[model samples]
Target: MYSIFGVAWFSDPRKLFALVRQRLNLGGVFVFSQPPGSLGAYGLQGMYKGGFAGPAMYTYRFSYTHAMWRSLLLSAGLRRSRDLLHEAPKPDHIGTSDCPSRVPE
Candidate 1:
């Protein structure tokens, strides 16, 4: 099993995916949780709304939407599997605080 956490946001995801695919044992699982709309596609849309830009958008590289991510995994030879996942809280519904006070670690 592997958990890539936040590193994929700033690096070459294709390279990362290739490395992970090479290193994993048969049937090994790879998992990660990215904040909603972190891709350049989404970030550009959100930029007009004054939302923060994620690393993917900042560098103008290594970006993916949910669909793109799925396709990428498949192209990397990873099988798609059903798993329970939660949707991120919508910005308008996340209480009165719209911005974080500190950068996430």
Candidate 2:
């Protein structure tokens, strides 16, 4: 099993997905936590205050919709597995999902 905690915000998820897929065995699990889709809908702005974000916050934080997440996983040969997935309900809480392809190794 492989897990990515709260680090996606500052890294390229596509590259990470490819790396994870290459490393995981059949039936192995992959998990990650990220900001909710709603945040993307609102245009990722004002996440920080008092000039803490400086001029390049976009390079440090990122957000995407649920559909986009599914697409990214699919492109990396992963399928969502409810049994291995969990998501928080709070509006400000980061959402999480898991993927595990059913095809034989």
Candidate 3:
């Protein structure tokens, strides 16, 4: 195969890590997507602006910045590759709320 590697829901990447541990083959690379930044005021601010962050909000969305993901991957025997962070775009504006921020991503 060209690449036995794969990407699972890094959303809860640790889950994927476990799967990868059982499924991945030699030379396989597991790629996953992630959001950047830590969960906190800034992160919460961004979320408030971005809109629709869902109840499963994270402190950070950066690429694989999760210690859990790292631990799971390592525990499952997957090598850590470069994390990729993707910032969801903020809403153009809020729907007439004085929240000072727009929709969350």
TM-score of each: 0.56, 0.58, 0.41
What do the candidate models score in CA lDDT, each in turn? Answer: 0.49, 0.57, 0.40
Off by over 4 Å in 1: 38-61, 89-105
For 10-46, candidate 1 gives per-residue lDDT tens digits of: 4466666667677777777766554445424542222
Best by TM-score: 2
What candidate 2 gets wrong by more than 4 Å, as runs, is 1-5, 38-59, 83-105
Better of 1 and 2 by lDDT: 2
Candidate 3: lDDT over CA atoms? Answer: 0.40
lDDT of 1 at 69: 64
Q: Which stretches of candidate 3 lie over 4 Å from their true place?
A: 1-12, 37-64, 85-105
**How many backbone collisions does model 3 have?**
13
Cα lDDT of model 3 by residue, 77-100, tens digit: 676654443333566421210101
Candidate order (TM-score): 2, 1, 3
Better of 2 and 3 by TM-score: 2
